[model samples]
Target chain A: MNPANGGWLIALTLVAAMLLGVVHLPETWPGWLGWLRPNWLILVLFFWVIEVPHRVGLIAMWITGLFVDVLYADPVGLNGLILASVSYLGWRFFERLRMYSVLQQCGILFLLVLGAEVLSVMVLGLGSERPWSWHVLVSALVTMLVWPLMFLLLLRLRTGLRVE
Target chain B: MSALLITLESSTRLLDPLRSFIGSLVSPIYVVAESPYLLTNAVGDVLATREQLQQKNRDLERRVLELSQISQQYVALKAENDRLRELLGSQGRLPYEVLIAELVGVIPDPTTFQIIIDKGADAGLSVGQAVLDAEGLFGQVVEVNRFTSRVLLLTDRDHAVPVRINRNGVRSIAGGTGDMGSLVLENVAISADIVEGDRVETSGLGGRFPPGYPVGIVASVVVEPTSAFAEVLVRPSALLDRSRHVLVIFTPQPQIESNDANTDGVVDLDQGEAAPATNGVENAQAGAT
Candidate 1:
């Protein structure tokens, strides 16, 4: 972390990701495009958690996710739980995550996002859940596909800005 | 701490103020998120032709002319209905004031059907005020901040409206199934005169919503001989996913902010004057025939 800004650059990136995650699609856009709206906040947090585990860990991710919960008007802590559970696994596997190629990390990210979905269902309950659509896996698969580009972009931003 | 919050926030609304405050803090984020749609709508307006504008103007003027004619008769009919209600020893209908508000955003989650309106507590809005579009009932205001409120639309899985059949005056309940286009009427007996295409309107039994506004049209009725209740599907008459402007209704009757922790979202008309609105199982059995 920098001496003067104290990680404000990281804070700005997370806020930018939160804003982008929620921008609505055009009214004339097709309905199926909604399934492709990746969980932007988590993807960015995964980058920061994997890169700077000493600074950005479960608590920071949890608080950032609380803002997402507010944006979506979800119950206050559901997203916090999703972010914390997912990022904790990222922290656990960081040495190997850093060693692996981006595509392989994409595979691991898919499992983490899938695990987050399972946590969401368990917390929210299956009483009124939609019929098994397999879209959960599709959405997770899409989030995984998004990771390599997102990772490179953030890496360039960190080095270009000299954030640390 | 998050586990504690999850339990406290869901089981009881011990966390509502915290949620509302955080929701307000996030409004700036919402404005940034909505800018793209705002830009597109502005571009569409610029591209519209003068002839199209004239056509829309003519259609609005014709609509105003027709509505004025209906309202003149409505005043007379309402006065006469009040006299009859007095004769029958019943409560007279209180007048309602309507305010117009624009939709700012629709909550984008697939699992919920909620929208944000531009008006809020500063505009005299309160939780439980009924919302409507030109065509039919839309939803009710659930959370009111300084500048905006969240409306739980009629199709949210947690929403239920007390309704009546316009054809037969039979009372029933319509519960949302998390689908934007339809709601499911609960516990309809097989013999109930409700049929496909029957108009369903607010019954005004719960007193939260004003009675007689169109809620939905009966889309289908499935009566299996072995099953005890008919599966009544209602297509909401209002365009839940399309409408841009809505009307907020202020019914003159005093309201108790319905606490969802206790009631199943149906509120009492008046705590002192009306029979208990809480006993729904018996109420359904009594009203189904």
Candidate 2:
């Protein structure tokens, strides 16, 4: 077994990739072209949770989520808590996830993303004075559509990680 | 371990130096990651572009047309310039230290609509300082970091500015409508000369803002005879959607420190007696209205 792989560098790269994934959440393209926002981070997190549940688990997700909170300037710990919960849930359900096909996995991931969106809205609504709108629903839909590509890329990245 | 944990917790305040050292170490990485690009064209490129001179010719034609129109205005301006010499004279000496800052980004979240400026506390920026563009008032400084400050724009619903009608001198306050372009006039009399096109300026009523700085121009008038107040709509003159640069005006106040120190029972009694002079103008206006 090649022991030189899956070090801190790989974990840091995963974090960077996950952070880059969130930029897709805010774009509004022309007409139907706009509906393609992939929940890149969630899909990446899902793949990593299934591949190496120990290395990139709940705590890692929580810290990355906190970084995202600062980067996006949302209420501190809102995304962190949600992302950590999602990672924990994903790891707990990793056995069932391994048996599923891409389509079934996408559907499950879509539901997870939807739940996260709802939780984020709830957190923001509690902290903010502004009225909630239907825009978040669109973002949830975009996250669902982006899942397959993110899942595939993350799966490919995981193949390179030599698990001990 | 429990005793050690308690000691560690107690000494957390002393760890600030360590935290700051770590922060400085990480700050360079952040700066490199987020720094905006500045492009420079060489003189050789300009010489090469001399072949494609049509754009330059077009630009010169536009300038000539603008110059002729400006010349016509200059003659009229030169004649009336002496008549309005006092207004022009006031413009000669701007009262505050105006620092120019470029608007870097607008935070899209409606709940806290803030804009980040290129200037920070390092550029003499402080919280509550006024930000204005060429046309009118823009925002106020809220959060100042080392390299940048966040300004809460006037159109934010939480923002309110004390203003007066230039025509009637009727003092009132305007609040933002969550739309940076519009403002709502609060507590104005039913009968006021706040017509469309009437300019509004900072009244220095609260001393939070400087006097005579243009706030906005009146956009509409909604008068209801049954209501005690008129619904005045005003559009801010600042081209907020397009303006990149703004002037952060620093108005230093000496009275705040004095007010803080003078918080005593005897001071309260003295303040009560002195309140009549301060409230006299507002009370008289309220009574008349």
In candidate 2, position B124 carries an lDDT of: 70
Q: Which 10 consecutive positions of candidate 1 chain B have the poorest summed lDDT?
A: B279-288
- In model 2 chain B, which range of ten residues has the least summed lDDT? B279-288
The per-model DockQ list reads 0.52, 0.15
Best by lDDT: 1
Tens-digit lDDT string for candidate 1 (B151-227)? 87887776777899999898888888877789999999999998999999999775677899999999999999999
TM-score of chain B of each: 0.86, 0.62
Highest DockQ: which candidate? Answer: 1
Model 2 pairs whose backbones collide: A38-A146
Place model 1 in a CAPRI quality band. Answer: medium
How close is every model to the real structure, measured as TM-score?
A: 0.88, 0.66
